[model samples]
Structures are given as C-alpha cells and as structure tokens.
Target: MKKAIIVGSAISVIGLMLVSCSSTPEATTTTTRQTTVTAAPPPPAQTTTTTTHMSGSGY
Candidate 1:
C-alpha cells in the first residue's frame, strides 16, 4: 500500500509539471481610438411684424 501511494503521488506531481511547462503564454494589447464629430448649427427663428391703421379713434 505504501509503495502504491508513493508512485501515485509522484505521477500526479510529474503530470502537473508537464502540463504547466507545455502551455504557451499569449500577449494582449489594448488601444484607444479618438473620433471627432462636427454638426452644423441650427438656423435662428424668423419673426414677422404687421402694422394696422384704424380709421376712427374717439374717447
């Protein structure tokens, strides 16, 4: 039983080491982009003026 336990533990450790060493690390990069948006100003509101003449004005 003791020999079996030791061999099993050794196998588990070697398996973990092999898996960790065989994997490759990946490099990651992030970039930020700036964008400008331009919009035309709206036109001013129009106003109309009307003049009325009254014929009779008495108090």
Candidate 2:
C-alpha cells in the first residue's frame, strides 16, 4: 500500500508539472477604427431690387 501510494503521488506530481510548464499558443487581437464627417451649413439668402422712372416730352 505504501509503495503504491508513493508511486501514485509521484505520477500525479509529474503530470502537474508537465501541464504547468507546457507552452500555449499566443492570442490574436483585432482593432477597428471609426470616422465621422459633418457637412457645413449653407449661407443665408440675399435679394436686391432697383427701379428707374423717366418723364417724356414737354410738361
């Protein structure tokens, strides 16, 4: 019984060491970027008017 227990314990310790010391694959990371654009406001409206009157002949 004692020998069996010692053997079992040794095997368990070796298994744990192997599992802890093994190398794992590196993880991959992805990055995303976002952009936003805003349009400028239109200029205000403007109006101009001109009038001319002329008198003809003699008065």
Q: Cα deviation of 7 in candidate 1 (Å)? A: 0.2
Model 2 TM-score on a 0 to 1 scale: 0.39
Give Cα distance to truth, residue 21, candidate 1, Å. Answer: 0.3
Once superposed on the true structure, which residue ranges of model 1 sit more than 4 Å away at CA?
26-59
lDDT of 1 by residue, 1-59 (tens): 99999999999999999999888566669667889988888888888889899888785
Number of backbone collisions per candidate, in order?
0, 0
Clash pairs, candidate 2, are none
**What C-alpha RMSD separates each model from the true structure?**
11.8, 16.7
